[model samples]
Target: MKKIKCLGLVWLLASGLTGFAKDYPVSSAKELSALSLKPGDRVLMKAGEWKDQQLKFKGNGVKGRPIVLMAANAGKTVLNGNSTLDIDGSWLVVDGLSFANGRLDSGEVVNFSEKSFSCRLTNTSVIDYNSSDDKVDYTWVSLRGTHNRVDHCLLKGKNHQGVTMVVWLSEKPNYHQIDHNYFGPRPELGRNGGETIRIGTSTWSFHDSFTLVEENIFEHCDGEIEAVSVKSGRNIVRNNLFYECKATLTLRHGNHSEVIGNYFIGNGKPGTGGVRIIGEDHNVRDNYFQDLTGTGNSAAISVMAGLPNPILVSHWQVKNARITDNLILNCKEPFAIAAGYRKDRYLPALNTYFAKNIILSNVSPLKVYDEKVVVNFEDNLIFSTAFSGEKGRGFELRNEQLKKGSSGLFLRPGQADFKPFWESEQIGPGWFLDINKKFTIN
Candidate 1:
């Protein structure tokens, strides 16, 4: 008997059998119900490779301590070759495993099954979980339940037609929290619809998600123009670090969302961008945009227009947006109005506020596609060798130039630990002087 010591259980290493917790074929809904797990209960799956294992992990747990299903060893309980997990329960947690070798047609590597509530998927990983065959589409992780969270996990190598992670909305709002995770490289799909994260689909853009995507790192995610495509209302994207991603965080649909306290560091890379705005009643504030080189639609910040009397699926007109207290540095286009999408009888952006921002050393600070788009631009500082005292291109050109003082402002910006080094004097305007640890892959 080969001894295998594990969390909350012991197992035979040779036979891949466990001592504690139920061991049943994860193939039946009736079998899972038979477990009848409760609060503080634990289940340990058999340690081995599971190919195409489709099962429902069901149980209920109370607050403070949720039920858990853990691997015999971290990263040892491998699920491969189109493997999928459907978690169905309240206050359950899945921890310490890896799901890999997923096929293209594999719908979702892991899904918080419908009706699940207060669940979490933490400290796990999903790598290379994508559709291998062409013309097939699938999401890597689908979050369908409510009040769930995905944290301290690693999701990488998503090269397929669909999004890497998604929050599917329903009759009730999905108040999900996606935090402290690492999103790895996703190569350019050369077409549309390869977003890193999509909050909700356009089919139900009117739904209120109330989701939060914060403290995550998006590394080299060159999938499409939109990195985190928001299609629902009242969502929040904050405290995230987007490093050299050749895309923008687009508010693609709905309204009343906020993107704040995020760091977008392009390091002078081509195609790298900051944020794109759509719809109305949104707030994009207290963010840092540095070294972005995208010119037109991929500008550091692009506000989009919409068609007249648009439907929920269509892009809505930008209205009553508050874009303030941001720091934009060394970008090609810091501000763009009606960016890159113009056709038919379009409605222009209106009643926007751009205030108290500090912009520096951009090739072109403002890009205006629709001159009819009006904004209340006030109290903004521009410190550049280029244009000065110009009210034409979205800037008012206030008095005195701001300088990047004698600090390691550009020190090793291409490295993984790269961040703009700001002196104590230049520490205001929502920019931080320290290394943003959320910028790394770890």
Candidate 2:
């Protein structure tokens, strides 16, 4: 009877029928790599500063029973100085780890390998991780494969030449969700490759990413004019906040994408851009832009002219663009139509619709660089004290009174329950709430 009972317990463990999974406490990367974790198991790293640890956590876990690797203490376990992580399996979670004071000359700081799927990286912080040589390119986080999530983390102060985070694409669409993270200040890199987040690339621009980038806060991210560069088709960017970030959320090489319900607060800063539109079948709607001071390609909305017979990496012509229902206030040159209309690049936006937009600015609202573009403008209202004589084809000058709402944002009549953006306490790791007090509105 005793032998039979022991064999039954072994069978239950082997078959994963038991709810009790083992939790191993590891002190080093060597111990972590040696352990074979099963579904529902956990490997907790001991609390302290771990230096130069290259941790490769690979395992397979089933649905509803993901293998977890986390810090023993949420914010106390720090990985510094040349540390990196690679997650290379399905249904794995990496949580509550901090990477600080690290410099990787090349290679990513955290990589979800090509085989990884249904994995999550949450409540983590990568702070000031840079390469000593600013020209050396390396991504901070690289997400490969499908069905991955990166949420509630802080990616701050990436001053290198490469992107801060990237979503790699393949033949099939990668359905990744990137939400609720705090992307802190990144200074200007002066050249290309300073984007905070890039989804796909020019080589993979024709593929569908199907990625969702929502509810993130981008504060002071002045990295080469693109805060988030969307380079694939069929993606959505919604409800995010861009605060004083001398950059635009550019749809650089995508088609059929949507940018909706976002806030761009420029605070009258220099080189503060809003959105640059390209490609076909795109929608830009329901966004609020305030106090922006950029013009031309950095206007609140720039419908760019593309190159004649454009290549894969060149700017494509904007076609079938729907720009509607946006609130533009106190921005300089709010609409830049036919932007970048050079001699060689004169392919104008075709069959575009601009409607139902409310603009209240003291400056001139429209700057149509090209006269041959076919854009239908209707149901748009404009009220500018400096441009009361400004008359255009598609908009009427109406005196609409604006009032401050409960969220400290000025709004028009019949518009209620609107928020300016997320508070700093609402994003990032749970332990890093004090960052809210560090920022001041200009």
User: For this target, which candidate reaches the highest lDDT against the unseen true structure?
Assistant: 2
CA RMSD per model (angstroms): 9.2, 2.8
Across residues 24-45, which tens digit of lDDT does each residue of candidate 2 receive? 9998889999999898999999
Query: What does the lDDT read for residue 338 in candidate 2?
Result: 93
Model 1 agreement with the true structure over 1-442: per-residue lDDT tens digits:
2333363243233222332334333333344456777566676665678776675788777676577877756667778876677888898988777787767465777899878999998878888876656447888889998999998777878887888899998978999999877788899998998899999988778889999998787889999999999999999999887889999999998789999988888987789999898888999998988888887668888888777877667778889999998888788889888876577536888899998777876355777788787778887767666765455555655445443323323222122433432111121111112323423211
User: lDDT (CA) for every model shown?
Assistant: 0.77, 0.89
Q: TM-score per candidate, in order?
A: 0.83, 0.94
Instruction: Assess the local accuracy of residue 392 in candidate 1 as a C-alpha lDDT between 0 and 100.
Output: 55
Clash statistics: count for each candidate: 2, 0
